[model samples]
Target: MKKLISLIFTLTILVFQMNLYSQKIFPFEIKEHKLSNGLKVIVVPYNSPGIVAYYTVVRTGSRNEVEPGKTGFAHFFEHMMFRGTEKYSDVEYNRILKLLGADSNAWTSNDQTVYHIVASADALETIVDIESDRFKNLKYNKEQFQTEAGAILGEYNKSALNPFQILNEEMQKLAFTTHTYRHTTIGFLEDIKDMPNQYDYSLQFFDRYYRPEYCTIIVVGDVSFNKVIYLIEKYYGDWKRGSFEPNIPAEPEQKEERSKEVKYPNKTLPYLYIGYKVPAFDSKSKDVAALNVISELLFSETSELYQKLVLDEKLVDFISGEMPMDRDPSLFRIYTRVKDEKNVERVKQEIYNAIEKLKLEQVSPKKLADVLSNMKYSFLHSLDNADAIASTLAYYVSVTGNPYSLDEFYQTL
Candidate 1:
């Protein structure tokens, strides 16, 4: 009877994995429900025996800031959320989660903040209750708020001393004149210094965002959609709606390309940055696929450029570039450090030539096909765990509202 039961369970898991790519099966297999108050719920069942991952994504970030001197409130709350709620004190929450064998944490980024927990499937409902309570009724005394604010300031100070972090802060400010993206997600030092005094603004900040409408819940692993949705409705249904939307100033077009050279006399090698702003990620954009291909051909160590710049000639420390994943248009930046200043323009021209060649016949059909095939296979290879799958879903959902674009992304090739 045990062997029969195990065989039946194996068949059931196979059925769900097969239906993962089906359109008609989409709603029932991996459910999405929106509450009357506009909260979004995503229930993903994996039946991976005993584990589950639950995440609440709030769609407010540093980009949502509009007040002149009060940037990074979204980031500030990432630290504050742990301080405590009226009902669930930090110690008590941790104690309860530990009792249930759950591990949880939260993160704030340029576009979103996600609070998450992973645990035995048995603890799913308890996790829901704790998170929903705080989302609706988070309360902190002034002293606690002030205390957390100082910690955020200290966190900022530590990051500011990092050379890469310092460069990015200055780079964003220079890249954008009017857009909120001008400031780093941590905001400017001058602004964060005054954050604690703006207590009233902090309260208003919570009121404006962090609403049911501004958040989405994702639950994955050994569970059923009905049970997860039922848990979501029980806990999150009554949370208030969000009324505010951010009005970040639109970035003006760059009329001419620009380059900057700053001698951080503290460094042995000179740092160089080459930047070009591009429209952000959109599901229908195959150009993004093309950009990925271009980057692979030009920037990888296997590429001719890397060997020439760093190994053959020993002119540059390394050549690297990245295309950001964002809901708003972001920059494609090429950064490198040279052994000496004499070869800066020479290396920059080579980088430009590489980009220009991508527009020409730079890649063979077999090579391009190999890259695309490798990309798809590599993505699937990482889906062996519940958290890996959930995190991948979260990444795409954070960029586009949809994650199943994984299919269309490959089909576009």
Candidate 2:
């Protein structure tokens, strides 16, 4: 009996020490530099032997499309950027990528567009040269611009086939009244239809947002910080900065609860989404931490609600909740797919009941500690490779413009 007590006490001490160590969650030294031209660069010296992940985060998304008729230009640029610059034609760019055996792609979201490449470390110089050239000297004629626009229209049509996509579009339109978040990242269908005729406007959009001040370069892997900076200076130093500042409109407060129902053209299991207006992502906010905790406590697979709704009653095949990190105020959304259409209301009410229980009752300290520890360790386990580390930091850098915010956020949790 005495030995058992002693072992338990030692384990407790070890856990306490581990929790203290985890306060500084980011294991690598983050080196940052700013250029005279207003470009920012972040370097992480990861242990990968011969590979690196390069990411360029453009802080413009559909949220920056505030003009009357230009809603899809940001995503359009995601496609157009690959059309290649004057120095590097699309064919030549593809050839070079194939030579280096590189994987490269770009994606646009509500708040930012990110371009990423995973390649050998030896190819870093060529990567910098081509990327800098494209950002600084990209040129496309009217025909090329219109071709990409039409392609985007086709892409939009394809995405519209998904019922969840339709529901998300309606939700955004219903959620915000004045903010550009009223539109999805793909923008509206009408704007995409009009995109082919807006070749001149496309030039202006690129000129406005593709500037040094609105971008950040992140390099993670077996790389030296000083070497990365020197290469950046050699290639991107002469690139001039632009003086465009977007007037992004702020969303106003919701005075009352709002709901909308979206109908699907094809038969499918009924999906239910409930979103509550929540505070924006803040690294130091206790409210944000609490929301994160609540998401797990009330909706995780082990939660009473999930056990009842999914395991016991077998009403829902899937149910989950998330507080997505966004630069501006976003949703704390609970989502579920009901097996039967008639049970949608019951599932929703059950979720409400679970939320009310969370508000009325306090979780035991042991459970809270367990959840926090799991969340922290799960994140730590994901940083196993260069690409994973860069990808994780890219999202935080997009939202907060500081990779260190990950440490601050986890500390709060």
Candidate 3:
């Protein structure tokens, strides 16, 4: 008994040390500067020679669309942002990017919209000038706005063809009653169809959300913090802050479980998604940490449930679960696609059984330690390049408006 106890104690110390060492994996110093206009600049001096990943994170998304008919405007702006400013037309912007051999794109999510560019370090000044100009002086007529809105409607119709998309739409709608999360980032089909008529409203959406107060500029690569800050100030300093605050309605606590079935017009394998209401992400919360651990323990590929349903019985094609960090309370979801419709119930029961086992039995300390170690190392391994580091930080920045939250969240894990 004494020998077993000593061994466990030693193992615990080693795991603690490993986690501490892993915390240092984010090797570069993160320098942050806030402009007087409320724009934040985060610079990470990575060792990648002559390459830079520049990201502009706007802290607004479909979640800000609180009014009834404005659901898809946030996403619509993702497309419209490229329409260019008075200084640089869409054609001119493309020509300049091609000249610099840069790759640029933008994406919108439930909580934020991000625009990213990967270019040479020397082109940073031009990058800042163009990006800042677009944000501050974007110019588009009703014709251009309507054209993009129509394109978004077409994109929505194309996405509806995917069964999983339909399932996700149904799941979100069934999960919440009041929160804007009830809608997908692309928003409702009806709202998307009405988008063309909402061109004037689109301008208002931009005016409300596209401001220095709601923006962060992240520059990662072989860059100097002083130089980055200087360029940002020179270009983005005069941008005015807007006073609009979204009056997002709080979601009432769910008292009962909800379920919905989405019928796909096209033939496809049966899909199952089960979600439980989880709290807003807090890096210091033990409850949130436990949810992350439980997701891996019950559903990851190494879990007993996965071995039984996927490898042994061959019932499910894939099984996974995630409780992604969000600005507001969100769902911890388990998803699977069964090979046959008849086995869907069986797979669901097997997942439930796994959850019950976790509740009834304590996981061995050694096993728990191993899971934590793997999770830490997996994340550390992904920070291999400048773009990867910036992209990773962008998500944390969008959620909490702080890049260091990544460290806090990892430490909590």
lDDT (0-100) at residue 257 of candidate 3?
63
Q: How close to the true structure is residue 56 of candidate 1, measured as C-alpha lDDT?
A: 83
> Candidate 1's residue-wise lDDT over 154-238, tens digit each?
9998885666677788788878889888888888888889888988899999999989877888888998888988888998888
**CA error at residue 202 for candidate 3, angstroms:** 0.5
- Model 2 gets an lDDT of 0.85
* C-alpha RMSD of candidate 2: 6.8
Error of 3 at 157 (Å): 1.2
Put down candidate 3 lDDT per residue, 328-378, tens digits, no spaces.
988888899999998888888888777766665667778888888778788
Q: Could you estimate the TM-score for every candidate?
A: 0.88, 0.94, 0.94
Runs in model 3 lying further than 4 Å from the true structure: 1-25
Show the lowest summed lDDT stretch of 10 residues, model 2: 1-10
- The global C-alpha lDDT for each of the candidates, from Candidate 1 onward, is 0.75, 0.85, 0.86
Superposed by TM-score, candidate 3 places the C-alpha of residue 43 at a distance from the truth, in angstroms, of 0.2
Please count the clashing residue pairs in each candidate, in the order shown.
0, 0, 0
Q: Which number leads on TM-score? A: 3
Candidate 2 residue-wise lDDT, 231-288, digit = tens? 9999989988999988888998787778888889888899998887877899866567
**Which structure among the candidates has the greatest lDDT?**
3
- Kindly report which residue pairs in candidate 2 clash with one another: none
